[model samples]
Target: MLSREIINLQVGQAGNQVGESFWQDVLAEHGLDQAGIYHGTDPVQLQRVGVYFAEVNHAGSQSKYVPRSLQIDLEAGVCDRVRSGPMGGLFSPETYLHGESGAGNNWAKGFYTEGAELIDPILEVVRKQAEACDVLQGFQVIHSIGGGTGSGLGCLLLTKMREEFPDRMLATFSILPSPKVSETVVEPYNAMLSVHQLVETSDLTICIDNEALYDISIRALKVNSPNFKDLNGLISKVMCGVSTSLRFPGQLNGDLRKLGMNLIPFPRLHFLMPSYAPISDPKTQSYQGTSVPELVQALFDRRNLLVACDPRNGRYLTAATIFRGNVASREAEVAVRELQTRNSNQFVEWIPDNVSVTLVSVPPVGQKQAAVALSNSTSIQELFLRTHETFAAMYKRRAFLHWYTGEGMDVMEFSEAESNSQDLIAEYQQYQEARAGDEDEYDEEEAPSEGFSQ
Candidate 1:
């Protein structure tokens, strides 16, 4: 069996403190085995994974400006391991504005401190680590594409890695910002463009949306914490969940090569809204808006099996609202119908038009509940299957869209070819039987026990 490895790189201000805390909490909570830290300059040996940390140089910095740093930590060590890594490598925008524009860097500091300088160093560190790893001959590398440092420098690093180690499986977990945040529109798009540039070079790219998580968090817990302390914790939990689902012995599927698959997993929130009915009691009938209890109940009702299974993946049902407005219901119904049509094959879109509803999807890296839930087997497995089906359906749907729009060759041709490639009918039948047997056993175990009459 091929062993899996994780190489973590720290970039920008977020990576310095908040990001680190989140990752540590996640690892500890999940009881993941820790590997040695991949100090950027060290040679990679040993049959283990490494977590590396580096600081990116934002434009504003003294002479000793470092763009980003990479570290590799095994699954066993305490959270304190992150502190031993380098600090102060990030390049803020202030440094560049003073150097090139010849203005008081502080004035343009916050606006221009894009951390562009760290791009090269980040790439260098990644390349060096890849070269040092003897065991990395067939290993895959997964990283993120979001945040100031990770999204910017990380993308460049991915490009460099692709050129240096063409054979390695390079996958990225790209984070999409929440719509409520100003950066949501441009940052994710930039990250996507970076991914697109290296798409053909890498094995696969997985996209995660921060907006979804934020919405869910606010709606479900009635709290909106954006600090790295909170956000990173959520993301770490999510990463741990995905890693566990693929690596845990009980969760593995014989037919799937977990190590070979280049997956980008993210969190999504689904919400449900029920139509409100007037109270029969003459005193309470005056209420026209949704009740708090009703909204809470709706959120719980729409919780996906996947979130319970893999909290780390950030797949959960957050909140639900009941709206009595006709306009709101009609608009929601239309949107839900469109989404259902789009994802008809794999997911059942359950949103109704006449209900006031909003679903939020958040990255689980910083979520507390999700982090705690990662160790549970039942929860992880359910999430694993749900995510698999969701992605598969998405891929198929996108292909169909491409084919229909004349952007690519007819997918039907490929489907027909796959159908005739082997005895799919027989294989499918066998698969169904096996699935049925497994379900039967599960049902038998879950069935109410027979006992003396109560």
Candidate 2:
């Protein structure tokens, strides 16, 4: 069977850096080097890995197939550095798009001018990539909401992707700025626009909080000062676990479509929080094998959650537990049945039992077992609360309004976007309240839950 071809469009410095490490993890998973040259000989397995990348050179050319990743940035230095780096051969040189002047952490600069100027060139590259695929399903974008290029240009790209290829999927791996840290004074302003666009566009948007990531690095990896390289590598591992079902077929939910079907019931409730077990880094800490029950329990712990949240307090609309790497089917069923009894972590009674358990025997690299859970929880309400609070504090005083207005963005758009952010938060809050009030009625009806197929 042919694997689904998905293009990866990494925008800005944060995006490219993250994609570099992401492909590293993917190459390792497929038994390939940093340059993406496959080490295996199995015809079927090789093609499966190839599905995720594009062969840059001709059929017989020296340049091997690289991940179909388009590295875009407002500044040229990062691209130049990557081209001269050890893995330069892994990517097509022509795919890098850049400009002389940077976006300067201003969303207006990126969206109105920089991103707009590069749209034609970026689209050209995307068009060529689309032409190469036998069945081009969609593209995945990676960037942060704190900076101009990553937040502003990233949103512009997503908006265009949605407009041009309305039929194809657009999944965004968005890095959320730390609520406590001051990345830039204008970050609050940038995040408001970026997140609003994410909510308006994109099919599946996974919010990876920088705060949560940093916490994990310090606690799990024992890193004194976790740099981008260290943090990105850890995030890449989670992406690998998330992509396992997409790259390899084993049990149910092996395809990207199923991932959306099983997890996303509503469009706006598309915020997915990923949690991967065995959080320890092998270099800093030992790789320990854990029981199915222990792994499942860890996923429930918010400390291991990719998004910073008190999940025990948040309401879950739907959840999926993906147990990969030699996990037994019976063990998976028993684990879910057990996790369900801990209603302290379970869904409200009124809503259907929406916990899904997908058990696949395929193991991740250098490990015998692993588990990742994608939960569509209301904890994102808390997530948005932080962004909105920061944004509102700035917007009320019209702080940094000129940065956007000067770049052709309407001043009112900020308020509108802030309103949009508040609406999603309110929606999640409402859902949490609905099931509780409707619980008695649901109980009287004796309806079957749309939960675990085990």
Candidate 3:
């Protein structure tokens, strides 16, 4: 079978740094060195390498593997650092795009002024990258919604991709802003605006919260002061785990489209929360092999979620659990079924077989087993509710209004975004409170939900 290629777009400072960490792990997993040269003799490692890399041969040099990715930022600092970094040569020089000034943490500059100016060139490069593929699958974007370039321009690119390639899948690893680790004061505004766009543009959105990363680092990894590298490493692991089936041949292989189909029940409610299990500090030497039942329990544990929402608070609409490593299919099936049967109330009763299990033979580099769960639960509304409250607090006073309006944005747009976000939150609430035969009752009226205060 031919490999289905995916193009990766890393936008803004946060996106580029996270992308670097993800590539480092992917290269190691595929047995490729920093210069994209395959040093390992494992043919299985390189069999499906083309999924995320383009095999290239230079004059009189060994075959070099280049990542099918684009590094973009409104400012040149992040891209410059990546180019001069250790894994610099792994990416093509033409794939980097930058501007003179940064986005100043304002969404208007990224989406309208600075980001708008660069969209054409970015799409052109994307077109060239797609032309190099034998079977193009889709595009994955890694970005943060707190900053100007990542939030504004990242969303702008998504809308364009939908227009240019309507049939292709669009997925994102979105770093949402948290009150605990906010870099700027306007993070809520940026996040709300980004979520509004994501609801309309992205096919699949993987939510990652800084607060959750911090909790994992402090509790699981035993880190005192976790930096961006530590947080990005955790995200990279989940990203790899999510793509394990696509990157390697497995009995239960799944792709981006398959994941979306299973996890997403409703079109507008595509936000997914990802959880990874058996996460421990690297300083600890001894790695224990976790059983299938224990692994399933850990995957559902709120402490292990990449986002800071509790699944118990909201019912699960659908879930996809991907296991990587050597494990018996019967064990996995029974474990998941047992879990579902034991906690049937946690899932919506209407959907039959709400939980999906996929197993891949190859494990991570230094682990006996790894499992990642993508859950489309109503509890994700907690995140949206948090951002909406903050945005409302600031928007009521017209704070930071001039910055966006100066960039040719209308004040009405903010209101519209707020309303759209409220509708999304309400829709999730409606389905969450929905029961098996009570679906017709929710179709009566579309009133604002007062229960969102929780």
The residue-by-residue lDDT of candidate 3 on 1-454, one tens digit each, is 5899999999999999999999999999999999999998778899999999998896577788999999999999999999999988889999999887989999999999999999999999999999999989899999999999999999999999999999999999999999999899999999999999999999999999999999999999999999999999999999999989999988768788988888888899999999998888777737565888989999999999999989999988888888888887778878887777677777777777778888899899888888999899999999999999999999999998999999999999899899999999999999988876645563313322111000
- For this target, which candidate reaches the highest TM-score against the unseen true structure? 3
lDDT of 1 by residue, 228-330 (tens): 4444444444444444333233212211123222111211111111111221222333443443333333322323111222232221111112222122333
- Which tens-of-lDDT digit does each residue in 1-454 have in candidate 2? 5667899988888888998888877877676777766675545345466568765554575535677888899999888877788777788877889877989999998999987998889989999988889888788898988999989889998989899989888888888887665678888888888888998788888888888988898888788898989879777878878877777766775566677777787888898998889787677335365898898888878989888888877767778888888887777777766676655334655555577788656677777788888888887788889888888888889887887898898988897898898899998887776644434454423334335554
- How much is the lDDT of residue 329 in candidate 3? 76
Ranking by lDDT: 3, 2, 1
Of 1 and 3, the candidate ahead on lDDT is 3
Local distance difference test values of all predictions, in order: 0.32, 0.80, 0.90
Worst 10-residue lDDT window, candidate 3: 445-454
- Measured with C-alpha atoms, the lDDT of residue 417 in candidate 3 is 92
Better of 2 and 3 by TM-score: 3
Name the candidate that leads on lDDT.
3
Runs with alpha carbons beyond 4 Å of true place in candidate 2: 41-44, 55-63, 281-287, 350-353, 436-451
RMSD of 3: 5.0
